[model samples]
Target chain A: MRILIIEDDQVLAAGLKVGLGLAGMTVDLVGSCAQAGEALATTAFDAVVLDLMLPDGSGLDVLRGMRQRKDRTPVLLLTALDEVADRVKGLDLGADDYCGKPFDLDELAARVRAIGRRGGGRAAPCLTAAGIALEPSTLSATLNGQPLALSRREFAVLALLMEHPGAIRSKGEIEDRLYGWGEEVESNAVEVHVHHLRAKLGREKIETVRGLGYRVQVAP
Target chain B: MSSLRRRLFAILVAATGIIWLCGILWIFVGAKAELEHVLDTRLQEAARMVDSLVAQNGPAFAAAASAAATPERYQRQLSCQIWSLDGRLLARSGSAPDVSLSDHAAGFSDRRIQGEYWRVYTIDNPAKGVRVLIGDRLGQRDQLAVDLVKGLSIPAILMLPLLGGLLWLSLGRGLRPLLAMAVELKAREADDMRPLQTQHAPAELLPLAAALNNLFAKVETARRHERDVTAFAAHELRTPLAGLKTHAQIAMAAGDPGVRQEALRHILLSVDRATRLVRQLLTLAKLESGLAAGQSERVCVGDLIEEIGAAAQPSGKDVAVRIDPALRDFTLTANRDSLAIALRNLHENALQHSPEGGAVVWNVTPDGRGIGVEDEGPGMPPEEISQATQRFFRGKRQTPTGCGLGLAIVEAVLREMGGRLVLENREGGQGLRAIAVLPPATSPCP
Candidate 1:
């Protein structure tokens, strides 16, 4: 898989190239927007790592130019500015992901690979963890290769947690995902769902971190 | 002593006095003149009657005068005297005393008799070679003058207070727009930066209100910019610093020594950068927030300098602190946190700019009215001193030490504390000197 990096800082770009290259990807580095444009015209890449600020112009311009040419390649934006408005602008420009500067090289490589896998159409349409597989496309789940019939509420609760594996999804977020807009949720709906999910899947499948929320660790 | 109300009131009172004096003089002079004219005309008619009677029957004129002497007939009306060309007294009116009129036989004359002023007119009868002298007691003339003055003065005296009251009321009404503005200002919160709503303001005061609102708009923009910078710095620094620490931990757990050493070096650089970034962020936040509003405490300048010196000593620089005995005992009312931040920035700048082994001196002394800080470093050139306190500005010689926000923060803190910070060269070109002049405290120094 080939990934293009558009960054102004040579040191950061070189570091990213080495890191992402080590993650089983071919990396092409370009330091300016002009060079990025030239590379995009001559080559087909699975994903592009774009820095928001460039010496020649803004990365938003590059993103817009790509979209104008009907290019659907996933673009991830890297910026030092963490302002809310800037993030909104990058997302509105059709960026696949946004990461701020001084990011973990591992995190960056993972995002790049995810975007690449998503672009390749081989990315998982279903999330499987700890003996349970959730088919997001059909809003269905199977345990041990057998269909596990669940209520609509249980399916929603599991889907939200599966979307962000290893992350502690808060109770409030689970409720929002389970309930429709303006629907008054039962105060203990998430707890009830977690109780049912644990009873159906195993007790150790869903772990709760105190003072935070619930997480489903991706099974090794 | 120079009150606007008092000055206006005095002006009005003086004008009233001048007008009253002029009116009194007019009454006195006009009444006397009119009275003299009437007396002259009456005297002429009396002389004509006496002359005709004496010519028709010379000795019978005395009887005629006597016949007219009835008190009821004249009704306390008139007094008259007649003198001949030979200066002999002629016919006189009813019980006219032997009081002589003036010997001057023509024109009008004023005289005093028995403490009463008289207006006398003398008319010459050339055909008869006789002079008729007519006189009226000055009391009657003075009485008319007094009556005229009383008529003019009564209403004026009665209306003076009313006029003053109206003037005061109108003056206050004229200033109502300013009062309304003051009331609105007093009602606002300290952090409220809303523009003043002055659409209903008086036309003359609208410009002043608009200018004030413009100033507030600028202040609000500046404050928003500072807040954005601080927030951005904090958020941007956090993830990188966290990643650096995590990577260093990962490297330390690795078995390779070269890789571990490189990771440690990277970690230290990242830590240093993070620390510098956090410090700048805090300083910027402190400066932007200003001194805590409504806080006033007695702060000792000398002790503050000592505290800063001790804090700087940990940075391994030999920072010397000097305190003038007079300033050591002096204290000022300020927010302690803000004052300490301002002083620390100055001391830190001095320390950073000095050579490795060179001394950084913090001199807190009375500068006739305030405290001064003197340092021993390659001082900023004269041209660069003015721009030193601008945001992100560094002198040509001092760019490498750190981010150039030190002096800017100092300037902001001083401004919030109601003091001025002045930068100048030390004597003999040793280094830079900064002076902070605080307002004199009310209580005497102990």
Candidate 2:
């Protein structure tokens, strides 16, 4: 799964990135509403973690912007404001879930996975296409009842592709999934991850889109 | 609760009863005097009648009565007698005493005869050489006076129960609104602080209701202020707590020594931030409780300013401190420690807002009535001066380590010293100005 975390506190944000990254989800973080908006326009993320209090503006502004643009990505608001009125207002303004500060990272990850599944129009935290199944909670992948071993980046790439079976993923968008802000990026990192995913999931499962990027074709 | 009702009834009922008893006593006294005067007139007329009969029918009429039934009421109620003016009684009625009733020479007199009080009238007709006396017992007159007063009192006696019933009903009706108000107060929810209803209350109770409502309004404001402060303090503490938790988690999860060391450093920093917040919170509480200042003492402004100038400089760093010469001999009566804290906070604010090379300037007013300080950095906006000293208020720029209680503490201390913390913008709005004005020496208020 791909997720974006928008929080102003650097230490908390760094911890969230590490925790969510270990859960086998590719996480990109931004500190302001404007940066989150720009990242949303440029990349495809399954869910967003929003903090109400931000350095530039309120996190609710980002949620309103996404909803205004008809972006259906699920949003979970994480804030220090635990008042019921604040929670209800955030939910009324198109937030999928609300968590107050001093939150448990594990519980936040569970909620993120739940919202991610709901965003994909699925009932459970498992994405599958043509018998290629990925369990988000355990980060386990299997092909036709046989377990498939994959690296973190390869698992992230496979999870993204399996979320929407026939949709094409641009190389730049895939690169955004594998890296966060202030990180060194290798030019062919996405290609290497896809090459590894194809070897394990079978060659025909992921197809190249020529100059565009890559896609996993649906079986008839 | 019922005392007010009982007091009203008891006082009013006792007053009316007193007035009725006094009226009955007045009537008894007046009737007794009038009855004695009427009986005296009857005695004089009886003496004249006996005198005329003695002139017409002489000694024969003298034997006419031991007492005859012809004029029974007069004969029974009064006694008649005639005397020779010498020392002898010539004619007498049966009811008159056998002895002379009086030793008087004329007119009317009171005499005791045979152990009964008697009212006697004596007429002297020297031409006839005889005296006539008419006498009645004082006991019978006393009895008549008692009967007259008793006859008048029956209606007043019968009216008592009716008056009591009316008084009770009127008093109950008058106090019904108060009872309703009591019930209204009793039925309220524990935290319900809405003003009491007064629209249907009686006019006499309006002031009480209004006073109660005013108290409710003040309490509500206090409750809201307390709630806001609590929430603000919690938020302040939680942010650092969240940071600490995150850093601790990262330290536990790190596999490399460098990463673990970095995480530990962040943890220490979080602890320091939390500690600073808690200490500031305690300082604010001390100032708010009005106990930290203790007692007022003589404060020498010159010595205080010199100490402030020397101590306020940053540790291991040279920060210029300037005090106006006019402040050298200035002295005031105030709480010394409180004054020191206020000055230190102001100096701290000036230092915090001043730029790297900028200096803080402290000066006394030309009139020598106030002390003012200014920072060299950009001043605050005009609109924020009103709320600058409010507790837990941070500007939108969000300065680092701004617990937002520094100015509030200074303001509280100044207020306790019978002074105010005045905030203003510098010339051309370049920097901020804060002034503290002390009470004049001659003023009585502390």
Candidate 3:
């Protein structure tokens, strides 16, 4: 998952980007409402972690604008506003979740993962296919109740495929979420990550469309 | 007489003394003349009786007069003499001198006898061809007048001390309420703002008591506001403290250098937030602490907006400065520093809510007297607009990083300048539009 962080405080935004990056998700940051709007316009983010107060304007200005354009990317509001009514307003404004500032980074990562798991119009945090069960929050998978360890990239590829069991995701779309700015990508990076995922969870669980991309199939 | 009781006592005693003295002097003047008239009548009757006795029994009266001795009290006051038609000194009283006492002008005469002033009366006996004279000293009538005045005034002089004591006591009783008020005021604690009791107070002192009560009420209100600000300050500080703790814990627990570096960055951010909060809190307290009131100076509105643009540029350099055409030369009467503070707050508020590339608009309102700021940020609901200016009121989930005193400082400054702050949603739900209205200057509108 690649998440965009809209925060005015440069230090905090940098810290959040690093913390979420180490959790195997690519993170992008913008310090003002204008930058956030521009970034959102050009990129398709899996989720957005928004700060309500920004240098140029409130992050809500960005949020409202995104909603007006029918951009339904999941949003998790990360602000210093902790009141119940404040959370309600954010939720009513189409935010998927609300988290107040001084929050735990681990908890924030989990929530973002939770949003990605529930993507593709599904509501579960765990996906099961071909006798392989995956928990996106823990980044762990089980084959017939047997535990298996996967590298960060391998886990990311599997989570994406598990999230959309029937849809084919192109290699370019997967590359966009797998790496962020300044991160070098190889020609076979997606193929390499998928090869490891298939070795651990059985190659039949994922189907490759010639000249297209990959998808996870439902169990027989 | 500085004391209420003493002043009343002095006035009463002095008035009584003057009136009594005037009445005594009036009676003494009128009675003195009437007394002299009666003494003169007695002198004339005595002279006629002696003249008749000498004429009716001339040899016998002379022999009886020679034998009679004058009483001591009457000796200096009276004397009698008889004269014959041939001018013979025929008979005289023992008190009379051997020389003739008067020329005997007939009814009354003044004469000098032995260096003493004398009043003399004379009677003529035509049948016997003789005249009689009686003379008394001028000093005698003066003595009588002195004796009569003393008799009337002695009692008044003796009663003066008693009257003074009574006046002092009554005046003290009349002024007791003021004394009670003084004692109550003196005994009160320094912070006490309770009203002075008005019951049992004199009608003259009720207004004073009521005014003191009003003062106490105002002081109490000020003290209460200070307390609320202090309490709010304590609560708001916890946000920075909580942030600091979160970052410190992360830095300590993390093993990766990248993770530690990230936590350190957060720690610095938390410190900055705390510092800003402290600075804002101090500014707001100073404004609400009465340093923000009563400074009327001529401030050009255009220049003032420019100053705000410069001071707040650090917050948002992209804030587009706008001045209504009519406001380019507009000037208003206000304290430059206070108005500058209000304008800065308004600008920061707009900057914090406006979108990227959105202009923080500045202008003179349609009326040309009010200075205004507008933005294209996400606007708030109508219900929360009224509460935005209250102290320590950070907005809901939309609450930003701030001390929450920005709008409050703006309000205090505007109100102290005899102006008001009006906040409304920007047209079409853009953002907030805030105005601070002050008295316009003498300069003509552009």
Best by DockQ: 2
Per-residue alpha-carbon lDDT of candidate 1 for residues A71-185, written as tens digits (9 for 90 to 100): 9999999887778988999999899998887687767777876786577555776677777897643447899898998765777677667766787989977765454324578
lDDT for residue A196 in candidate 3, whole number 0-100 = 81
The 10-residue segment of model 1 chain A with minimum total lDDT is: A17-26
Clashing pairs in 3: A86-B397
TM-score of each: 0.45, 0.69, 0.49
Whole-model Cα lDDT of every candidate shown, in order: 0.70, 0.79, 0.75
Q: What is candidate 1's local distance difference test score?
A: 0.70
Docking class of 1: incorrect
Which consecutive 10 residues in model 2 chain A have the weakest lDDT in total? A7-16
TM-score of chain B of each: 0.51, 0.75, 0.63
* Candidate 3 per-residue lDDT over residues B1-446, each given as its tens digit: 27767777777888999998898888888887897688788787677667666766865656434333235554546777677767888777766776666776688888887786777888777787777777766777777777778887898888899888878887778788888899999999999899888887889999999999999999998897775555445435654654566567668756788778878877887788788877777777777797656566777777777776776646534556565655568776667787788888887788877676778777777766677888888776787677677776555424446667888888888777667899898888778788887644432345
User: Candidate 3: lDDT over CA atoms?
Assistant: 0.75
By DockQ: ranked, best first: 2, 3, 1
Off by over 4 Å in 3: A1-220, B1-19, B44-78, B83-112, B125-127, B171-174, B204-273, B281-323, B328-341, B350-362, B365-370, B373-404, B407-446
lDDT of 1 by residue, B1-446 (tens): 68656676678777877988897788778876886677567655654555565556655545544443335533544456666778777777764555666666676787776676666666676766666555666676567667777887888889888888887777677777788898999999988989888878988788988998999999998898786456434434543454474455546454557656656665666566667767776777766775244476887777877777776646565555566666567677777787887888888777776666666555444445657777777787898787677665544565333455777778888777667789988878888788876655522255
Q: What is the DockQ of candidate 3?
A: 0.08
Which of candidates 2 and 3 reaches a greater DockQ? 2
